[model samples]
Structure formats: structure tokens, C-alpha cells
Target: MTVTIRDASLADLSVIASIYADAVLTGTASYEIVAPDETEMKKRFQSVTSQGYPYIAAVDESGDVLGYAYASAFRTRPAYRWLVEDSIYLAPAARGKGIGRLLLAELVARCEALGFRQMVAVIGGASPASIAVHQACGFRMVGTLTGTGFKLGQWLDTVFMQIALGDGNASEPDPESYPGTLFAG
Candidate 1:
């Protein structure tokens, strides 16, 4: 399957919502107990894109969305402006086909190009597959919070993996050129 990664559009939200809903319903990647509807997804999409964050989708040759990924502020505070967090979700058929890796790589490149210095992956449930994909994209295991989440009738751990983008912390960010709307006062 030829998969292309591109900026997500409003038309893609339906499929994106489906993909995320499935993940929330059946997988531990997302902690939400109830899958959100398309309206809610639209609000989230607007929130991310409005802030100039990179929200992307992986589409098949026929123009079907197979998966999606995006980078959002790790925290809304001004002090964390240079840091962003990544989230990725794939359709059931898209798993294990390296789609996650592709989405993550593209997301990383886009974030770096935008001048983000650090990208963090907060892997809910500490999913092995998620961890491996992040590792393949040059993220390193930072720490794991055991029993941090409870779902599916059991306790789950949350893993933290991080990668340096651009110059990372080796040099200071140019205060004159903050990336995106994240630095808006």
C-alpha cells in the first residue's frame, strides 16, 4: 500500500475520528473511556491547527486516511514553549506495516523545521509497539510511571520517551523567532 503523509484537513476528520475511536475503545493507547464524536474531534483539530501545531494524516493512494498524528504543546504553560508532545493513531489494518513509524518520522521532521527543540512521547499503557515505534524514530526511554493509569479492569503504566529536535538544549532558542502561536502572550 502506498501511504502518503500530509497535513490533515477538515474533510479527513471523520476518518480520523473513526481511527481514534477504535483506539480508545479497544486499545490502551488512549485513556479516554468513551470515544468522542466527530464534533468533539473537530474542536480538537481546530485547537491544534489554530495554534500552528502540525496535525497530519497518513492516507492511502485512493485518498483514504489510514492513520493520523499530531504534535501539541506538552503543557500549555509559556515556559514549555519549545517542547511538544506527539500522538499517533492507526487503523486496525494499518498496524505493523510501519505506518506509525512513517507518521512519527514526518511529525518529527515537521516539528524540528518549526524550531521545536524537544519532542516527547507519552505512551499510555506503556504499549510495547508504541515504545518500539518511538524508539525507531530515535526516541529514548526516559522513565516509566508504573500504575499511573487504570483501565480495562487493570493497572497500566505510562512511559515517557523523548528525542531532541533541531539544536535541542545545546543552544538557546532564538527569542525573536518563537515557533508557531505557542509563544503568543
Candidate 2:
């Protein structure tokens, strides 16, 4: 099945919400116990897009959303303006087909183009699939937070992985003029 990656639109919010809902309800990728409704998801979509961050969807030729990904402020502080946290979710049928890798690559390229210097992945449950995929994309294991989350009748770990974007702190950060600051403002 051919998949196309594109900027997510308001019309895609329902499918995006559905994909995330499945992950929240059944997978360890998301720590949220309750699935967020479409309204809440729409708000989140707007929050990211309005800030000039990329929120993307992977869809089949038929226009079905197979997965989605986005970059958001790693932290709200101004000093963290050049850093972004990435989140990805895929439908059950889309797993293990390299779609995650495709979506993540596009996210990295978009973030780099936006002048973000670092990208982080906070993988819930230290999922092997997620870790492997991140590793394949050049993210190194930063650390894992043990027992940081309680879900599905067990304590879960959150794995942290990171990758450097364009120029990644090799030079001093000029937050005042960086494109990444658009989100900080």
C-alpha cells in the first residue's frame, strides 16, 4: 500500500483522534488512560499548527489516515525554544510497515527546517518497536524513567531518545531570531 505524508488538516482531526484513541486505549505508546475526544484533539491540533509546528498525517491513496505525527514544545520555558518533543501514533493495520519511519523522517526534516536543534522521543513503556525505530532514525537512547507511569495493571517505564537537528548546539543558540521561537512566543 502506498502512503503519502502531508500536513494534517482540520478535516483529518477525527481520524487522527481515532488513531490516537486506539493507542490510548490499547497500546503503551501513550500514557493517557482516557481517550481524548475529537474536540480535545482538535484543540491540540490547532495549538501545534498555530504555533507553526508541523503536525502531519500518513494516509493511503484512498485518503484514509493511517498514522499521524507532530512536534511540540519540549518545555514551555523560553530557554527550551530550540527543542521539540515528537509524538507519533499509527493505526493497528499500519504497524511494522515502515510507515512510522516515514512519518518520523518527515517530522525531523520539518523540525530542522523550522530551526529546531533537538528532537526528543518520550516512548511510553519503552516499547521495543518504538526504540528500534528511533534508533534506526539516529536517535540514541538518553535514558529510561522507571515506573513513571501506571497503566494496564502494571508500572511502566518511559524511554527517552534524542537526536540532533541542523547544527545542534555546535554553535550558540540565538533564541531571539530563531524560527523555533515562533512557538515560544
Candidate 3:
């Protein structure tokens, strides 16, 4: 099965929402309980695209969405302008293939091209695949928040993994800009 990665469109929102909702509702991939609708996802896609970020999907030649990945503002502040947070989700039946990797590779390329200097993957500890994949892609586990999330009637851990896309290590962030303020409310 050949998997192709490409830019996601508004029409792909339903499939994306289905895959995301499946991951959220059934699997331990995400911690949210209320599954978002297509309308909500479409708005999300639009927001990301409008901001020049990447929202990519892996699909078969027949145009079926196998999985999706995206990079969004890590923090809204101008000081955090170089940073982004990412997410990847695959269709229930589409796991175990390299689809997630393909989707993320595209997102990384676009994020870097957009001049993003850092990318973070804040992942659920239950998804070892996510952790391993990000590691293979060069993201390091920077922090772990034990019991930061509650899901499936149990406390869930959140892991913070990150990679630097640019050269210098920024020790001092600009104080005037509040982090995570870039996304329009």
C-alpha cells in the first residue's frame, strides 16, 4: 500500500474528525472526552492554514485519508514565535504502517520552511508509538507531567518532547510577548 502525503483540505475535515474522535474516544491517543464535530475541525484546519502552518494528511491513491498531522503555535506570545506544537492521528485501521511518519515529515518540512525554529510534541504517555516515532524523527523527551491528564477513568501522563530546528539555543526569551498568544481567540 503506497501512502502519499499532501496538504489537507476542508473536505477532508470529516475524515480527520472521525480519526481524531476515534483516537480521543476509544484509544489513549488523546485525553479529550467530547469529540469535536466536522465544523469544529474545519475551523481548526482553516485557522492553521490561514496562519501559514501545516495541516497534512496521508492518503491512498484513491483519495482516502489514512492519517493526518499538523503543527500549530506552541504559545501565542511573540517570544514563542519560533516554536510550534504538533499532533498526529491515524485512522483506526491505518495504524502500524508508516503513515504517521509520512504525515509528520511533511508537517516538519513545512513548519521549518515557515521559519519555525522549534517543534514540540506534547504526547500521551500511553502511546509508545508516538514517543518512538518522535524520537526517531529527532525529538527529545524534555519533560514529563505525571498525572497531568485524566482519561479512561484513570490518571494519564503527558510527555513533552521537543526538537530544535534552528541553530542557536535561545536562553533568554523576549519578555514583552506572552507565550501562546499567537492564535486568535
Candidate 4:
């Protein structure tokens, strides 16, 4: 399939919500017990895009959204402005197709271009597939939180992986620049 990656639009929220709902219901990638409705997904999309964070979708030749990814503030504190967290979800048919890597690579590139110094992937349930994709994109295993989540009638671990963007910590960021108003006083 010829897949294209582009900025996610308001119209895409329905499919995005469906994909996320599937993950929430059937997979450990998300920790939420209930899949949020489309309205909630729309709110999240606006929250991310309004903050100037990159939110992208991967679509097939027919323009169907196969997967989506985005970067969001890792933390609300000013000190964490340089770090951003990544989230990705794919349709059931899209898994193991390298689409995750494509979406993640694009996210990393866009975040770096926006001056973010680091990107972190907090893999829920310590999913091996998620870890493999992150590793393929140059993220290194940082740490793992064992038994941090309970879902599907069992305990799950949360894994942390990180990758440096741009100059990373080698140089300090300009005080005047940041992803949107996340650091605004």
C-alpha cells in the first residue's frame, strides 16, 4: 500500500477515535479502560494542534487513515519544556506493517524542527512491538515501571524510551522559543 503521512484534520477524528477505541479495548498500548467518544478525541486533537505540536496521520492509497501519531507536552512544568511525549495508534489491519515507524519518524522530525530537545515514548503495558518501533527510530531503552498498570485482568509494565532531537542537551534552548504557549507564564 502506498501510504502518505500528513497533518491530521478535524474530519479525521472519527476514524482516529475508532482506532484509539480499538486499542483501548483490545490492546495494552493504552491504559484507559473505556474508549473515549469522538467528541473527546476532537478535544484532544485541538489541544495538541493548538499548542503547535505536530499531529499527523498515515493514510493508505484510498485515503483511509491507517494510523495516527502526535507529540504532546511531556509535563506542564516550565523545566520540562524541551521534552515531549509521543502517542501513536493504528488500525488493527495496520499493525506490523511498518506504519508505526513511519508515523513515529515523522513525529520525531517535526518535533526536532520545532526545537524540541528530546522525545520520550512511554509505552503502556511494555508492548514489545511498540518498543521495537521506537528502537527502529533510534530511541534507547531508558527504564521500565513494572506492574504499574492493571488491565485485562492482569498487571502490566510501563516502559520508557527516549531519543535526542536536534542538539539534545548538548546545547541550551533559546529562552524565547518553545512549543506553543506550553511554557507561557
Please give, for residues 1-185, the per-residue lDDT of candidate 3 as tens digits.
Answer: 98889888888888999999998888777877889989888888888777867888899989999999988887777657778899999997888887777777778777766667789998985478998888878888899888888888888888898888644256543344322335435
**Model 2, 48-87: lDDT tens per residue?**
8888789999999999999999999989877788899999
When sorted by lDDT, best at the front, the candidate numbers are 4, 1, 2, 3
**Model 1: per-residue Cα lDDT over 25-113, one tens digit each:** 89899999999999999999999999989999999999999999999999988889999999999999999999999999999999999
Q: What are the runs in model 2 whose C-alpha is more than 4 Å off?
A: 180-185
Which segments of candidate 1 are over 4 A away from where they belong?
A: none
Between which residue pairs do clashes occur in model 1? none
Superior candidate under TM-score, 3 versus 4:
4
Task: Provide C-alpha RMSD values for all models, in order.
Answer: 0.7, 1.3, 3.6, 0.7
Tell me how candidate 4 scores on lDDT. 0.95
* TM-score of model number 4: 0.98
